[model samples]
Target: MIDRRGFLRLGAVGGGAVFMSGLYGKAMAAAGYEDFYFVQLSDSHWGYKGPANPEAQNTLRRAVESVNALAVQPDFIVFTGDLTHTTDDAAERRRRMGEFKQIVGGLKVKDVHFLAGEHDASLDNGAAFHEFFGPSNYSFDHKGVHFIAVDNVSDPGARIGEAQLAWLKADLDKQAKDARIVVLTHRPLFDLAPKWDWATRDGEQAMALLMPYSNVTVFYGHIHQENHHMSGHIAHHAAKSLIFPLPAPGSQDKRTPLPWDPAAPGKGLGFREVEAEAKPVAYQITEFPAMKG
Candidate 1:
């Protein structure tokens, strides 16, 4: 039900289950797994104004259109982070956050969730984001899947800190070993590249807490590319951005944002659609280069 580039052709089933297509298909209904789909839209630098991406203002709208056009509507959408670019001015920060909320309000799916990105937190240490969205960290349950939205970007110097870690431990302690868990955050939870600001300081401790779970997947953003890693059985996957992309870890002399490539229009600007409501997630490249260079 999908083509060569790996897009999903949703095949819905009764009783909350769905089909996923990529190079292969998976029922995604094994071991008490219920099926549902969600979209991950990350790093949409809404207030950013620059030539790095001329379509900066329109990119988020384009991403929304793409998701709206999907054959099957996602049960919900999770914007991983970086909803707005950072600025030194406080009023501008509030303006951007308000504008972003207005933009996000247009999504067809009402069950949308937002998290913090360093860009959104770079000013006032996430006060603006908290005002627009609710608490930076929280958890929810849907269709047998337990999701934890951790706030790793709100604190300066990039860390989960001890208080949140304790809360995480208590939260996880209540869950049964067989429960499926997914953690969403704005920063990678490992030492991807500390020099490039891609690594989380106390992420080691957070990982230790999650290490006890048999089914744990960390879906994060900030790196803005399709990359994956593993800390033991836990799989860490990076979702592509709705804004411009950044270079690979240590790929350049310094970690600089890559300009929108006209040749590979969709090279770095797209959201992720996880089919089967879970893994194996069919991470298809979004619609063609949405905007011309």
Candidate 2:
């Protein structure tokens, strides 16, 4: 059995995406402390009209409503990636981003962080995305944890080139030895499957840059499902999509968007709530689905 710290170390070497297994134990360890909670919503795919999810926009709206209705207002919200679907028309892309902003207008929390997925960046290498959402990569500290948002889906898909890697190194170097680090991006840093554009091109180099950090957690949204693994002390988590869920890698011959089942309505529209606190290092993840009514 792999321990939490050991699991993160293995993720550093093996390049496998890591997630925390003993969630209950970790949460219990941090009991009786002031914990901060943030919501992660991904793959909204605004302006997408398809049979796979006939009510995509409505579903997204429902998700925003759900977040606003939370008993404990989140510290902030993070839209991991895929804010809009790809299209040849630049105006269309901007329109989609516009719609996305409008949909989240109900967000009770003020600070909302955004990242770019391949669909949002690949068309013109994120020119429009950044124009509407600001920098694709940035870093900040909240409640003693260093959070770094990286742009891994830069052209060529899932490649965190030299410049970003250097930036990441610099960012990590500035933090204290024991500060908990949380890295967020659109693609998984591990090689979930390269052929299908699921894994980052040079994720191993990125992982090595994070190896020195004692407590690190990498959160991403792309595959449109929930998955967790461990790399040393670092935990890798993939979030569910607000648009639709895709089959796990190798589970199907081709990775395609799964249609919302009338029989299983409201199945895939959900988001992950992450809580992290200082001292003793703890995290609790709760997944919430959109309200059916």
Best by lDDT: 2
What do the candidate models score in CA lDDT, each in turn?
A: 0.76, 0.78
Measured over all alpha carbons after superposition, the RMSD of each candidate to the real structure, in angstroms, is 5.6, 7.5
Q: How do the residues 1-293 of candidate 1 rate in per-residue lDDT, one tens digit apiece?
A: 56322334332221112222222124343555555667778888889988677767788877777677766677899999999998988899889999999988988999999999999985577899888998899999977677999999888889888999999999999987646788999999999999888989999999999987776778899998767787887778787777788888887888777876766655667666664344443323232232333
Pairs that collide, model 1: 36-277
Poorest lDDT segment (10 consecutive residues) of candidate 1: 11-20
Candidate 1 local distance difference test against the native? 0.76
Tell me the TM-score of each prediction against the true structure.
Answer: 0.85, 0.87
- Candidate 1 residue 292 Cα shift, in angstroms, is 11
**Per-residue alpha-carbon lDDT of candidate 2 for residues 1-293, written as tens digits (9 for 90 to 100):** 77433433442342223233232224334435455768788888887888778877688888888778765677889999998888889899899888888778778998999999888898788898888889999998777667999898856556899998998898888976655678999998988877778888889999998887667788899998888777776788888888788887768778888766987667766786776643356666666675435
